[model samples]
Target: MEDSNGSGRGPTVQDVAARAGVSISAVSRAFTPGASISKKTKERVFDAANALGYTPNLVARSLATHRSGIVGLVMGDIRNPYYPEVVDALSRRLATHGFRTMLTTVWGDITVDDVAPSLVQSRVDGAIIASIADADRLGELLYKNGAAVMLFNRSAATSDKLSSVRCENVEGGRSVANYLLDKGFSRLAYIAGVEHIYTTQEREAGFVGRLMERGVQLFAREHGDYTYKGGFDAALRLATADTRPEAIFCANDITAIGAIDGVRAAGLRVPEDISIVGFDDIELASWPPYGLTTVRQDKAALIESCVDVLVEQIRSGQRTRHIQLVPVSIVERTSVR
Candidate 1:
């Protein structure tokens, strides 16, 4: 046998045994999670492995067990700051629980058709989809294959088949509307994002419903496509109009920031001339320059809840069909009066 298959060549079992002065089986036993091995032998093998800079081959071990210790994460909208926070929290928490994450990016609104193949081919024991729609064909396919799924930052549309963790968007919307109304602003407008997303729908509904209760109506409406540029242009149109709204409620903080700039460009001061409110208290929302008043969602709690459900199913083969709706709170700042 060759002397050793060192570092770059891949640390083979033979190399480990040669360095440790043990049989090939002893090296294998040392790496196995619960295999029976004497403490002295195990220590020697591990010490040799450390000296040789050997990383055990999880793939070969996975082949023996027919299960890869990886969970797939299907997410997109990386452009949004909120989504990255979600990914970071999940990655860190999952690592602590001894599971690896595989990310599969989905552009725009997620569709099962677009994301399913990559996840299935990767053979992930379980998956967490950050953006999912109604329990469609894609949901069915993933279930049929025995891969447990968890939905992140989405509502309970597909709760029958999957675990979901999301924030209370409607409640946040209602609170903002009330805040604006209490501050005594009568002329108000709404800047909506992509119409199809549930977050936008629920938020708009809550705001409108609250306004209707107060016997007031929004002065105007613009579709912001959940984008900075969209909000900027929409703000310009609102500002240039003969009757500009006294306040605007944007679907997200990014749009709210853009609306602020747009209003300033239109020769108006935030909260001084036209108050603005936003949702999702992202890092930038609190910047001295922006100081946007918005709704806050706990990213850490969302990830903990999502990972708890996913790991429960993956490890024990028990199905947990839960739809967890986390609460949101309003964070007051200079943007709103």
Candidate 2:
């Protein structure tokens, strides 16, 4: 039997249905998950499908179900070691649930606006926006187009259209502050990530707020822009200043690692001259060279929660907003005195 295309390519669903002595809808239902079809008919359809070497076309199935079975993972900086871990775990989890991940990187010349249309066109059932500086527009576009959108590791203040799963950034910051203060470091400095991002603002607020509560003030603040070079430069400047801080808290692990090198370049010893702490305990944080005292965001818990929320939204065809905050804890190491 010829395919619908009449190219004699191979056996199609139509041929399978004919060979099984069933309607096309019966064959389709037999292959669909949780679809209601009688056991005898399903067995017949499967036997015919096997004999004809008929494989269901995902594209055609998507057209009929209006679900692409694709989840778009939008990110800005894939270079960060932290994000790669997230991607790996997230992709694996999504696969177990019978979904595929489509990675879309928006950075440098490629803005969110440029990619939003293509993602929508791809008919993605859901999206997880991970670590984008400006995700409001993209989130709005996807939400309006009937796709479930969840912000991973970030939040939007003004937009109520998106769901999010992130760590308790404020609490994490407070923990770091208390840890440093308990170490008897009076003069404390902060190395911030991107200034406009919500994570940066919340973390700084928690850290500084706790410091104020303890009758102390932030000694200095520097912008690291969440980059290695940015962190290094900021640390160098802070270290060379006339009145240097006794301890510095970086926003993330990459920044903290860079700050370590920066302190050494300024001829200072870690925890001996200036105690350093970081957030997000990435794999590199535990290394011997940079045993960073940092706040550990539970990556596994975060991904599990994120996937659960997004999949529920996709399956239910509901865009109910949810914001989940995974708890964070401090990991003590040699970096802090």
lDDT of each: 0.81, 0.89
After the best TM-score superposition of candidate 2, give how far the Cα of residue 125 lies from its true spot, in angstroms.
0.7
Q: Residue 253: error of model 2 in Å? A: 0.4
**Candidate 2 clash pair list:** none
Best by lDDT: 2
Clashing pairs in 1: none
| Worst ten in a row by lDDT for model 1 | 1-10
Count of clashes, each model: 0, 0
RMSD of every prediction: 3.9, 3.6
TM-score for each predicted model, relative to the true structure? 0.85, 0.88
* Candidate 1 lDDT for residue 153: 76
